[model samples]
Target: MRADLDIEGGVVVGIDGSDASLHALFLASEEAGRRDCLLHVVRAWTLRTAPRPPEVPPSTVPSVAEFHDWIVLRTRALVEETLPAPEDRARVRLHLPRSQAVGALLTAAETAELLVVGHRGRGSRLMLGSVAAICVRRAGCPVLVTRPHHRRAAGRRATAGG
Candidate 1:
C-alpha cells in the first residue's frame, strides 16, 4: 500500500469493491478534483484474512509484511476502474492500513477536508452500513455517505393496448 504519512485538507474515500463504494469513489474524485486537492483512497484491513504463518523456532512472534498483497491490488484496481484515465488514477493516494475500517478512515479524516464512504459494503443489508454510519458520526471532517443510483429502463407511457 502507499501508506503516505498524512493528508491535510484533502478528500478521503473508503472503498470495498462494492457498487456503492464505486459510486462513492466517483463522487469523491469529483469533489477532490473540484477542490484541487489530493484524493486519499483507503481500504483498511485486519489479519483475519491472512493465512497462518509457517512454524518458526518458537522463540519469536511471527510476522509478515506482505500478507496484504491482494488488498493492495484489489484496492488499486477498484480505483482504476472508477477513475478510468491513467492520469486521473495517478493523482490518487491509496492507503491500506492494518486496522478496522472505521478507525482507519477516521484516522485519515483527522487532517482531511472531507471523508467519503459507501452507504453500505459488500455484506451489509442496512440502508447505511455500520462502518459508514460510524464514520459519519465520528469523523473529524465532514463525511459523505454515497448510495448507488439505479436507473430505470426508458419506455413509452401506457396509453392503450390492442
Candidate 2:
C-alpha cells in the first residue's frame, strides 16, 4: 500500500479486467460519487509457473515481475477505457497487488464503507464468483455484488410482471 493511499471508509471494488468487473467498477464509482467518498479499485494477480523439462532453459519463461507489470498495465488500460470521464477517473485509486483475489479484496474491505464486486468474474460459471462470495461472507462492511446488465433487466421484468 502506498503511504498516501487510504482504504478506510472508501468504496472498495475488486476489478479483474472482466466485463463483469468493469460493470462493478462503474457502479462502485457511481456509489462513491453519491456518497462523496473515495473509490478504491483493486486487482490481484498470481503468477503461474509450469514445470519445464531438464532440456529446457529457464529464460523462456517470463519473470514474476514481468507478469505483474503486464497485469497492472492491462488493468490500467481497462480502467482508462471504461472510465473515460475525467471526473470519474479522478476519484479512483488503483491498487494492483500481486496476491490472491480473495485475500486482497478482504484486506481492502477491512475498513471500507462498502465492498463492491462483480457477481461473476472472468472464467466463473456459477451464479456468484468465488471472490464475491467470500467477500460477502467475510467483509467487515456492506457488500454489493453487481449482476450483469441483462440478468438485472430480466430480473426486473420478472418482478414487475409478477
Candidate 3:
C-alpha cells in the first residue's frame, strides 16, 4: 500500500470550520512544507435535496457555488493565519464537495500520502466525537491523530520526571 502512496508528490487533508479540522489543517500544512509537497485541502458540505416549505421563497435558496466559494475563502484565511505565508499559494488546492464527509474524505484519501485529523470532530454520533476514529479506520492512507498541544507537553513533562 505504501508503494502506491505518492509520498514524494504530496498529501490530502480534510478541513471544515470546526476546531478539530483547524488542527488537522495545521498539521497537514507543516508536513507538506517539510516534505516539499503539495497540500490538498478538501472540505465536504451537504445541500438540502428536499424541497423547502411553501412559506420559503425561491430566492432564499442558497447557491452551491457561492457556498463553496465562501468555504474556500474562509479556509484560506484560516490556513494563512496558522501557516507562514506560502512562497506560492498555488501549492495549496482547496476542494469543496457537495456530498457527505466520510465518502468524500475517503475518496480524497486515495490520492493522499497521509491523512491528518484531530481526535474529535463536531457532530453527533454513537461516539459523539469520533471523526478521527472513522477516518483512521477507513482512509486508505495513513492517518495522524493530533491532540491538544498543552496536553502533549504535560504528558512529556510527567514522563520525563517519572
Candidate 4:
C-alpha cells in the first residue's frame, strides 16, 4: 500500500455518481459512524479512462483538469448531501486518484477496515461492473457492494410486517 493511500483503518467507498454508488456512499458513512471511523470516498479518474459522451467530438472532450474539477465539484456535493447527519458528513474524506477505479479502490482499501462500492457503475449495463467485481475479489479489506432495495420486495415486507 502506498503511504498516501493509508486511511488509518477507515471505511473506504467508491462513488461514480450512480444511484448504486450513492447508496454505497450512504452505507459506508453509516458503517463508519457505527464503527467510529472515517469514511473515505474514492473518485478515481484519468483522461485515458474517464467516460465521455458518445456524441462529443474528440477535440471538444473535457481535459483531465476539467474532468477532475467536475468530479470534485459534483461528487463532493453528492457525498455531502447523501449522509443524513452533519457528524457523519464530517467524517468523510475524499480520495481523488488519477487512476483506474479498480486500482484506486484496492489501494485505498489497503489500510481501511472495509470497502464499499456499487454493484454496477455508469460505464456498464451488466449486473456487476468490472471495478466492483475486481474489488470484491482482490481488495485487502472486505468489500461491500451496495444494491438498492427492490420496490416490490420492500412493499411486500412492509405489508407482511403489518
Best by lDDT: 4
* TM-score on alpha carbons, each prediction: 0.78, 0.81, 0.71, 0.81
- lDDT of model 4, residue 152: 58
Give per-residue CA lDDT, model 3, range 57-111, as digits (tens).
6778656665566666676786776555666355787766666666667777876
lDDT of 3 at 61: 68
Q: What tens-digit string does per-residue lDDT give for candidate 4 at 36-79?
A: 98898988877765656444578797766677776778777888
lDDT of each: 0.76, 0.77, 0.65, 0.79
* Candidate 2 lDDT: 0.77
Off by over 4 Å in 3: 1-9, 48-59, 88-90, 123-128, 153-162
Sorted by lDDT (best first), the order is 4, 2, 1, 3
- Total backbone clashes of candidate 3, pairs 3 or more residues apart or in separate chains: 0
State the TM-score for model 4: 0.81
Question: Model 2 clash pairs?
Answer: none
What are the clashing pairs of model 3?
none
